[model samples]
Target: MEFYAGSRDACYEAKSAGLPKASGGCLLANASLREGQLLVGGHPFVIGKKDSGNRSSRDYYSHKLAWVSEKFVVLWDEKDKRGWLVNGASALLHIVMTSLEQLSPAFKSICLFDPASIQEGKHPHQPDSATEVLLNINNRQLRIYREDDGPPRFQGQVEICYNMLEKMIEYQLIVLERVRNSRIIVPRAHLEGWDFRHLAQRFDPIYPRLAVLDTNGKSWVDFTRSIHAVTLFGRGFGEIIRPTGACSAWATLPCGKYYLAACAADLQKIMDGHGGQYSTPLRLTDDDIWYIPDKSTGQCLCKDKTDATHSDLAQILLPSDMCKNLSLNPSGCYQTDRGAFIFGFNEIHQWFWNDTGNPFRKMAGESSDLLLNPGISYMSDSSVFRESLGIEEVRDASYLRLVPQQMSSDNYTVGIICALTIELKAVGALFDSTHAYVPSPDHDPNDYVFGSICGHNVVASCLPDGDYGTTSAALAAGHMCRSFNGVEFYLLVGVGGGAPHTNKQDIRLGDVVVSTPKGSKTGGIPYDTVKTLQGGVHIINGYLSPPPYRLRSVLRLLLKSDPNPPKAPLQPYLDQIAQSVDGCGYPGQENDQLFDSDYSHLAEAETCDSCDPQKCIQRTLRPSTQPRIHYGLIASGNQVMKDSKTRDRLGEEQDILCFEMEAAGIMNTVPALVIRGICDYSDSHKNKGWQKYAAATAAAFMKLLLSNVPVSNDRGQRQQAPMFSG
Candidate 1:
């Protein structure tokens, strides 16, 4: 084969010699080419060089400056031959040669192709009408057309397209070498006559252009933007991208059966030998559709049953035989002896499946995954699904991605338990803002109100209106612990009866009493005592668990910082609540009254107005309005303390500072600090007037203590608790 560059006469001579003309103004001798020979130009050829005028020359220069070349290749084919023409090969070669000449002398003798050797088919070459050549170069595959077979002419000359052909050969060689050394294990069945060229063509256009086909082979344009498929092999899974760029996974279980999994977990179980079979075997059902949840968006794959045409959002339909062969629950969820196997539905109900037999369907054009229609009560919310599946609830993506490490105990969670709605509201007012409520499966009818206070996540719970006392408190605390897993400590804050004594501490109305350990026992003790006459005296032994050491340390700090605790700054919160017509407001400090234990008078009276002034114990001076905070033991029992003599006796024996009905129960479930605002003196004068102010004071003190506490970190080492002197 002879290759020429420069004049058009050279091409005419080649034609006279009966040689085929190739693109880029070159000719090839058909006879010599059949023997596998290579030919290349010795120098460059300058085409379109016309001497028009000075202005034309400037215009040509401008054109060159503006020219932005594109990547393209030409495809041509004959009766039995086909090849590709690499666009811009000539220009690229010229640039490469110029650069090489300046780099080293060795490049001077390096010829791209030999001109003397006129042998045919000697070097590896791009085959005509071959798919391998096109794939190797990452070019879009196209049908090979011949001159007689189509309107466009076809030509094949090895010498003219030498530069592009050489590059294609180099790329193919590199690919072949990598495959030879690759560690990818292809099964023996797949290895039989495995032609990569054919595979490339088959999977060409891996990404869909305009539309994709559903399981039923029906095309739809508004498909899920990016559906992915992964294959599970052994213990791991791999992603498979089709030529049309649709992603899906395939898994072959140890049972020697292949199945399509909705997500990684379904296939992962089989890999782990954990009976991780698909809810229903793929073979048992026809038109069996599965949806995977997108963890990021909290959305699931759902099918629009109302649409006549098959859509991505429409229910997946499996073969009727497959459905009949498998045993599925009414919801179409797979049920095993262990439990139901619902894929993405395990986490927030991101996906919904419609059983073919179900008569009800979603209304047309409603795209949301949430089942809003009435009568559809079985659909799982994200929390319920995760709980039933024994998986953790899917949290916000930001929290998941940013905090990869497990939550630390240092990340303090403060749980506030209130026995009344007023108490709950008072505590909630201390926080800056409330968090959006996301229902949890473990939480009961009265869900926790979540907020943030002083950088700590505060979860507040209130007992049902009719329920109060230790038993109810224990149940509420238990629910809080289960639902809010990371809660480090709890604060039982509400109103309590003060145990004022003539000696020791002067506990008064509206005073805050905080639970502190006495010796080894907790400050809050259950006084559900049974008086037994042993020999000559009655013995009273109470039940108690020591408060957490960290809480004790915090109490010590709070006392050491202040000699006389000042009234809590809680008026703002009280005022905010008072604005609401249903809210409780301050009952006034004048209403606070302290009566002698010996004095008993008023009966069935709403206020002291009916009582005789002389009967009431007279005082020379009135006590200050500032509420004092006291730290000592608190007695907790099922019954509300009313008699002052009984309160004094218990206070003297146990050195208790206050009495409340809930703390003892919470101690049974969680190590907590009991903060109670003194509403009454545990006397006949007890009334509901002081309950609101007492709750406010306790909540205010809680806020102050929490504000001073350092945020917990992962180190787990205890830090110095904050101290408040007053």
Candidate 2:
């Protein structure tokens, strides 16, 4: 730039300009194409027209000009295909028009720039220092984000990613989402180099605002092949930014070190392709914490890390020695007084302990420090991070997982609890990205899986195999509440018997039933526990709690979407489940046989094949196979209703539209809404054939419902990375 800055050809400089909007939306074309103008960094710039001498001068009107240190401006001349970058200094270096278009493709596609959109990005440590700049590109998006390199910088050069200005013209890359970590700060008294000062123009907490790319779209997956998709927090579960498939590989830090981390399944495949000879004899190819030993000597070897690997197995990783004082924390790593290190698996925090003993390994000294402890976390089953980081969990439940802490459990906001493997399958199939298992507390026996969908992080759990009924669901829900924090609400999703014999709903097999209050009774009614004296069931202490306002509000919007909302919105999701999980497809209505309430499924019949069709109840044919969603009171109990008479009697008594085994118990444990896909009429005719499709319908509805639910209660705000260098 210094070379070009000296040439000083017929380049342009701005003294002042005017706009009706009086904001920054101007493209510096020749007079013809220009229509409107905007202020840049809160000041208007004018391109002085040439006199007979071909020179330009400042034309100061009533508007005051900003200082040299106050603004950074871009003057785009679309007519001449030229643009300039000015730092409020007199010298204006022209930016090659090709570079700008390389990332955005067409200049015509740019939106009107608003001064409000330009944010002041400062160093996290030195808050007022403005030495680094970032250019973020999304699908059809060109935006800028700022990051202060903090303590990670080498000398004065920024450590945060900043190669965009250098490479945009030749090789353009698309960033998944804009970079942001906006937690407020108080400068650390002891830390030496990081004394942050508030800017002259303070920051808006919602910096780097962007429209997240559609999770179902393939554009990002294809784009990831060439460059990394850097999601700042809760990567896998948060849908933060996924480097997915075989192309999902990158150095997972901003310091520019090539520290390649991969899932257990992907480790070998990545190493095989990028293998290089190391300076040491050991190849070091596998991706797990291990120690190599001499075959003859049979002694522990290469012991320098993982102090609490046994008792702390997958919980935390403290640098081998822990009986010491501490230094600073970077990202999540801490150095102790003894020079041993303990790093958080991520950029946030977690607690640690002293021991885990195994017969195969030697004992290390007791970890003594109660100081700030860093730990490991996963966003999936066998794991759920403590919800204290930014991750919007969910994806197509694909297998691309993250081991490193891109998402903590706090990253997960919605909890889905299922009771069977088929039900779990349906829920898992809908995850935006399936997170690697993060071990949970021993008391939480429920297996958890984490993901992000629609704008919320989702954590799912299943009751142990062969477990059914209220008690089992209660235990699972209790465990989830204990381990997976930050969940705003829970959805008990799975299959249940449809009590369509009642006049309220024509719920057929595979239709979805959402629990909504009816009359004076609430949504989920524990009919089995209710007092049934005087031939009418007495309220079982108000039956159940009303659905949470967040859920109720979303439901109202869903119902009001249309008098007859087409199945179009949910088709894509249903098709996804059908394709991923076999038998989840609509199991033709021909197999949907509803027998007379008095007629029992023949004791010898496996399906309805041998049963008398003449005795079957005739019902109106549905217009299509699309699952209809019905919202009303649901009858919940401890026992499965295999008798149709009991089911109808309960429905009529309780004003129920559906019958399920788990909801009563779950509602008692965790305040939630019960959604059941009608697998069969609660009768002897109930079979496993409709379970999968039924579960799919319920899960699809859950996804659709969430699509309308806002990421409530600041849950979407990611926890900021540590700005202090300890």
Candidate 3:
């Protein structure tokens, strides 16, 4: 075992023998020599001063000598002639020695009286002067140390030992400094005259605090106060700068050399080899060691060398642990060392490093002269950069489409079908707002208008101009269903011929008629069906389904209520239609005269103006002038019911309240309520004057009915009918 002893007598002996005097008037034994019996008496030895030309060497040697002499001490008893004290003044020496002994078996077996194996060098007292001692401590083979006697020898074993010992002392100082001021000094070394312009260009955006220093310790460029000082040392040289908070140091090789040393170019080469982009930032820790091939043709980046493509280049080793407490991140930074020259794959922040100063302020200052000129004031109003970066291309108009397919199904639940344009206009005016139109692939040219009415999204559509009858209505309903997913219920709102029966009901002109179930038929009855033999009896073919029971219950409740809430007035909607379209004005109650079912009018007359009033059949006087809302089955067919005889026959057989051309067609596709305003008595004396007024009354009643119906949350899905049995 090796031991060290120091005393006041030893300090005098060391000075007389040309040895260095350590702190506290003591002399230090050669710790590396492992002397068995160390005497406390003084011996002459000289501690040489470090060269002033190398500041790093001076600091390293000075600090390391002071620490080793003060921390560890061994003493001998001359009278007993045996080694007694280990660290004579320190109370913690036993604990430190016990921990050391537990760490290594070699330490446990070491004897302080005899350390001949450790001190085998020829110059035992002057261990630093012996080249063999330095080589042994540095783990170099004894044969190589004996053979190499050139200047390279000075740069090898001795330099390695100095660096190691210097690092140990520096670590202790770093811990002490960190406690005093939360900062540490990092050592760095780099190549001579290396160009850092490329590295600065890429890394400045990510690491704004980066600064480069030249070999003379002068900064390469002026930097702001916010920038951190990054010292760059020349090859094989290092220095301890003032403690800066969280700082890093980088080492580089000499100029024109690529793989001889670790530098920025080596990191760049790794990035370029891997497609110049990373999926994640690469992190390099201080303790990591990376090895690069000395020659350019070597397989430095390849994971394996099974193809016999290995190069004869010597390996360049980078021991990053020499610079302690560093975490290097290669994100947007171009010059970063990643172990084994492998680039990570990650997103990079390009402008994260150098964003300290305001670039706009510099630009404004440069153009101050132009701004001062009165005639050049317009230049400040115009921005060339803004205009260049603005959107410039106009989108194609052909891409725009306005159709029902673009409407959202979730927004609408009620679909309104109008047989005439006037009918569509009346209902459309009740809508709050129209939605954006979307085009459908189907060739149906029906115009669809979307709006909300009574808290429900209502889509009103009209049959193409000149199109009439149940078949056309069926096609329009199918197209609407495909475009809007499917509607909850359809409101067939328009004018229809009144089927007034003497014993059944007192239906009159300009009154609204809501379709309801009667006996076997529900909602609207298709009167055009041809009777066929079924079980030896005539049966109605292609029977239409009834309107949803929920809607029917609401209608029944409204009809049974006293005074029917006075019917929501339709005059406002009628006036809106009149202002927008001519001839859609109210045709007046006088024009709404209901002729007897047996009366027949002149064939060529457009209105009752030229017709003889004496020829028109008169009706029984009604009690009130106000329009009434009637609920009964409405007869729908393909043909217009202009003949009084056919209308009466169908009315008596099916108990129909009104006759309309489109209801049968729509009822086949969507379950709906057919609301009609009686315009004529289903007789030959039919006039076109009362059609608009009748259409308006029907639309108004529809708005009232919708107000009473609850809004449903049934998107496009089918809903079960509410039970009406109770």
TM-score for each of the candidates: 0.42, 0.47, 0.41
In angstroms, how far off is 476's CA in candidate 2?
A: 1.0
lDDT of each: 0.42, 0.44, 0.43
Q: What global local distance difference test value does model 1 have?
A: 0.42
| Cα RMSD, each candidate | 29.2, 19.1, 37.8
Candidate 1 lDDT by residue in tens digits, 1-726 = 111111111111110111112111001101011112212221212122231122243233123212201111211111111111222222222222222223234433432322212222222221111222211222211222234432121112212223232322222223223333432111110101111111111222111011101111111100110011110011111111011111121111111111111222222322233222354332221122333222122112333234333212122323333344434543333322221121111213222222111112233343222232110111123453223222343333322221112323223377888897667756755553334343555436444555556456567777876899888999989887777777888889999999888247877677788888767556777776657676766555766676677767666766674332323334333433343213355565556567778877478787666666655555433354556778778889999898989888878877878888998789878978888998888888788778877887787678656644554544544333221110
Clashes of 3: 34
Question: Which consecutive 10 residues in model 2 have the weakest lDDT in total?
Answer: 189-198
Q: Candidate 2 lDDT, tens digit per residue, 94-139?
A: 1211112122334324423222332223321110112221121121
Worst 10 residues of 3 by lDDT: 350-359
Error of 3 at 534 (Å): 13
Query: What is the C-alpha lDDT profile of model 3 across 345-423, one tens digit per residue?
Result: 1012100011111001112123322211111011111133112212122223321121112356556788899888778
| lDDT, model 2 | 0.44
lDDT of 1 at 216: 18
TM-score-superior candidate, 1 or 2: 2
Off by over 4 Å in 3: 1-407, 442-445, 502-504, 532-542, 561-564, 567-586, 596-598, 620-624, 713-726
